[model samples]
Target: MALAQRLFRTKPTEQIVAEGGHGEGGELRRTMSLWQLTLFSVGATLGTGIFVILGQAVPKAGPAVVLAFVLAAITALFSALSYAELAGSIPVSGSSYSYAYATLGELVAWICGWCLMLEYAVSVAAVSVGWGEYLNSFLEGLFGWSLPAAITHSPGQDGGVVNVTAILIVLLATWLLLRGASESATANAVFVLIKIAVLVFFCVVAFTAFRAGHFSPFAPMGVAGVTAAASQVFFSYIGFDAASTAGEEAKNPKRDLPLAIILSLAIVTIVYVLVAVAAIGAMPWTDFDPERTEASLSYIVNLATGATWPGLIVSFGAVVAIASVVLTVIYGQTRILFAMSRDGLIPHIFQKVNPRHQVPVANTLIVAAFISVLAGLVPLGQLAEATSIGTLFAFAIVNIGVLVLRYRSPDLPRSFRTPLFPATPVLGTIFCVIVMAGLAGVTWLAFGLWMLAGLICYFLYGYSHSRLNTEVPR
Candidate 1:
């Protein structure tokens, strides 16, 4: 009973309302509109993962990879619904971390925030590395010059030494974020448009070369292979929930949050499925080589068409798309840390916004430095898988949090309630768990170690430092 009281209890809604109604510390501006919020979600969702994951996923499931993309999209849809409801009920910058705090208590909230570091921070690194490869390709096509293979790749992976291009991209993102959130969002919307155009172009060109025979031996590896490929492809869906994280900034979070989340996911999924169908139709599924998995989709297009211009266009699109990902992911990361610092779960530096720009400068720098090191040194595949495990675990917690909140605060005014209540959230949880189970053992070990480190930091610093522990006068 004592343990339950300690772990499951939360402050009353009255207190939560009082605290949330007023800004924490300084008056941070809420300037984002519905269009900007939607663009943020779209920008974060459509990035390097989709540009390259097909090569790795298609070889596993053949034409069945199309089904895997659909499966992953369905799973993501459930969780997006859950997020929409929670964002409306308790609009806050911390995303799932804030939701867990309101329903599950401070400790779990802290852990969720820690887990989010993997989703945003590590994801930024992984995507930045992807950007490097495309940038290298672009330069090689345009200037006929490329960085030395040793400097362009990560150490201990296929003769890479530094991944200098990845480091450069991360640094650029950090600089952009330090400028201001509103400015970054505007730039992101433009990039999102360009990226969508490029994918549509790919779909058009590839469909021209479509052949019916490519899908004949679909699922040659069977259902298990499809599920495994779905697990891998699931990483492509990570950014759909980014809209929920911007709850504090949205003008009408209740009405707009759900629209952004669902709309972004649906658009991205359609693009993904179309691209997959077109790519498969253009080439035999058996021809996909997983060993060259890091190459941009344009490389495959060039190989299939024997034309260099289409490949160059795709490469250019990839570079811009990845830059947009790094920009938006870093934005999400700073906001999350800002919420944690406001709650006293971490140092105040994360919450310190520059008065001139009203941006979380310290938080951005910290995230950029960590991402720079990871992108500069770590192999892309390892970083990508590890990011997938972390994101799926966070999604599972968010799904469970929705159910908990529905029961715990039944009267909380929600702008959007998940359509099917218990069924939707329950299915969301199960889907996330199944995908998580399919991750490699090494990825799980890395995730376990990261969680352990987070727990230690919470016990050593966050538990006692938490603002929740500080008494508020009646």
Candidate 2:
């Protein structure tokens, strides 16, 4: 095979476009506006991480946990800029995966898409599990009764068996996605409003209890701790870039893609910082216990304020918040797979859309099945770290892709461009690397194993079936 043929395994871009050819699938409906796209990103980005991750990270960074949130936001900003550039130029559905295929090569594209599967699919499962806990808390708060431990908690946590509630929630989201994209996005916007209101409510109540003494001895774990915690807390910011995935759907891809991404990131980052400040200041950072880290936001509010009503509201908000996260993440997962399948890198089933709904039903079902199994069986901590590693890896690739595309196809029409060019992407790469390095050895091992599996799949299936291998007629 020629070099280009080996790399892309399909017709070159010039030939493909000359023949008026795109991937196998039909175009997605371009119904989303900048505001909806921004909310989609926010809906995906804000969830369990802020409600649950703080307790785990605070012990590591002490008062410096606030600094960790800031660092993570800064790091996310770098990648968001890079994504804005590529997304504007490509204006495709697969986000970084599509951008990589167009610029990096087919093989690299497959790897990026595969890693994104981890970012979206596994993260949905992890978020669903968190949702289950909040739902149980909400139910108990309302009725003084909850599901059995075996059906509520994942296996190996508190000696539970399966997470039935989590699995059910995933299944429910799957059904909703199969209905249609417009329906899902509309419902997500509503959920986003409710979730935000709950967070604002918590901040108000928690801030009322704020004590300056709690912030004393700031940076108790020092700068090292701040960096470590920032790395872990970085996962909370993953969804902010999700707006880029809707590149093709944005009203004006070049203009709105970047705007949606940056606006969503800024909004979510502010919300997270405010919530963290309120939660920690309301109660001494030292008082946060790891064991109760999984409690509903309401529980945290109740503990801090000694009021059952605040906890009740918080629990209600968490139930809705986590459900929205699962729905949005799963939507993202199916769409990316749909893009891949249309490219002939995955089975055709992934690209098949239901005529009635115009959604990738098969892809949604497959993602939901995997996520349900994961939510039902896996531990939250292990699943969370793995998801983080996958997302960071994909973010790094998007940053690098921006630089590569700038050199390889500089004249290509781009609606938006990264402000600093090489410097911005370079900084983005470094920031992702630093965060990746902070992950535990076990997380790295899991990532390695996942990559190895991807390699095997590529050689066996993707390489042979890639659409790039097909020649376009003169």
Candidate 3:
């Protein structure tokens, strides 16, 4: 009983806040303003998915993919509300992991942090591969020359040797991260504007070719297809909570974190709905080819204008957009690891901060090295399912953490609260599980294997070395 209690030890909310909570660098500054935080959320959330997912989702839901985007948005909103409430109340660095530690226990927090590695790290690697493809496309258009297939494609792709451009982009983002958080957020805001402009332009052009006949068989694949597509579209909404990860750095974390979470979702949902509606109306749903849809936005533009310049412009925008995704996702990864390290759940090296930059330099480099290798050598076409499932798992935990906190600490001053109380979190958890159930069997097996590996590490290292066990009085 004693050992069990210790293993499931929950960190007191006050201690969590007071234990050098700015993370390892006690002077980690709060430089992000409300506008910058919102832009970061918008930028991180507006990743390669909007540019790539339409092809896959359109084929699944036909013209009703617009409805699928709405459905996915609704599903994500439930969790987003939970995130806002907790972020407002806790204002911690480790996104859901820190929330879980405060409301649940160490074991759960460790698991949540481990799953985030999948959501952020692997996702960055996958997005980096995409960045390489679009970069090659842009270069081929501008200079009539592109990197060789071996250097631009991942292994098992067109006999690829290594994705050198993918590795390069990851290294570039890593260099930016080593500079500091404020610089990265400013750069991300610029990227967000470029992405929004490109999407808005695509919508305007696509509407010129809109036809009502496209709606004749809107739900051609039925309700099942809509649900399936929504499940996948959910991936497009993955990085909205990224703003929550910036809790420690926000100038007004309690107010800005919640606003950023809600506002970012609202912005991305509007863009997704408009783009989906415009794309479906502009082209026959039957004509959306999955194999050729990787460059779907550019393809849509080319079809609308009957010219190549628009497609080239969209491709250039895509290269820029995906590069920003890689940047923000990798940034989120390092912070989560830094938090875990501060709790002594990982090596101390990750928690060390560079006094000059006020950033976890070691943590950033290690994560960058690992993600770059994956980007260069791995074929991540199928890894997206794993990423989706991992995110849903984290969402489910965050929802549960909210409910637990509300019951356990009713008087905790919250800058924001889930509007419907238990209903919001309950529905959020249920929807996340339902979406997760749509994934393939292989994905579950892989997730399980990953979790098992995490547990092994916890028992061997984290359990013994955890700050909660060693420092906090039992």
lDDT per residue for candidate 2 within 328-363, as digits (tens), equals 888888778877887778898887766666677767
lDDT of 2 at 140: 86
Measured on C-alpha atoms, candidate 3 has an lDDT of: 0.87
For each candidate in turn, the TM-score is 0.93, 0.92, 0.96
Name the TM-score of candidate 2: 0.92
Stretches of candidate 1 off by over 4 Å are: 1-8, 11-25, 156-161, 377-384, 472-474
- Residue 445 shift from truth in candidate 2, angstroms: 1.7
Q: Kindly give the number of clashing pairs for every candidate.
A: 0, 4, 0
Model 1 weakest 10-residue run by lDDT: 16-25
lDDT of 1 at 249: 65
| Candidate 3 residue lDDT tens string, 1-474 | 377786778888777666534555545667899888888888788987888899999999998899999999999999999999989988878899999999889999999999999889888888888776788888887889987888888888986899999999999889988889999998888888888999999999999999999988879999989988998888888888998878777899999999999999999999999999999988998888888866888988889999988888888789888878888888889888888888999999888888888888888999999998999997766565588788888999999999999999999899999998889999999999998887889888888888899899999999999988886465
Candidate 1 lDDT tens digits, 1-474: 254454455655445434441333454456778788888988999987788798899988999999999998998999999888887777777888888788778778877888899878887887776666688888988989977778777898667889888899888878887777677878888899999999888888888888999999988999988988888888788898888777666777778888888889988999999999998998898888787765647866786678898888888898999988988888888888887888788998888767777676777899888889989997656545677777777788889988887887788888888998799999999998888787789888888888899999988998778776665522
2 against 3, candidate with superior TM-score: 3
Q: Candidate 2 at residue 468, lDDT? A: 66
Judged by whole-model lDDT over C-alpha atoms, candidate 2 comes out at: 0.80
lDDT (0 to 1) per candidate: 0.81, 0.80, 0.87
Model 2 pairs in collision: 9-468, 9-469, 10-468, 10-469
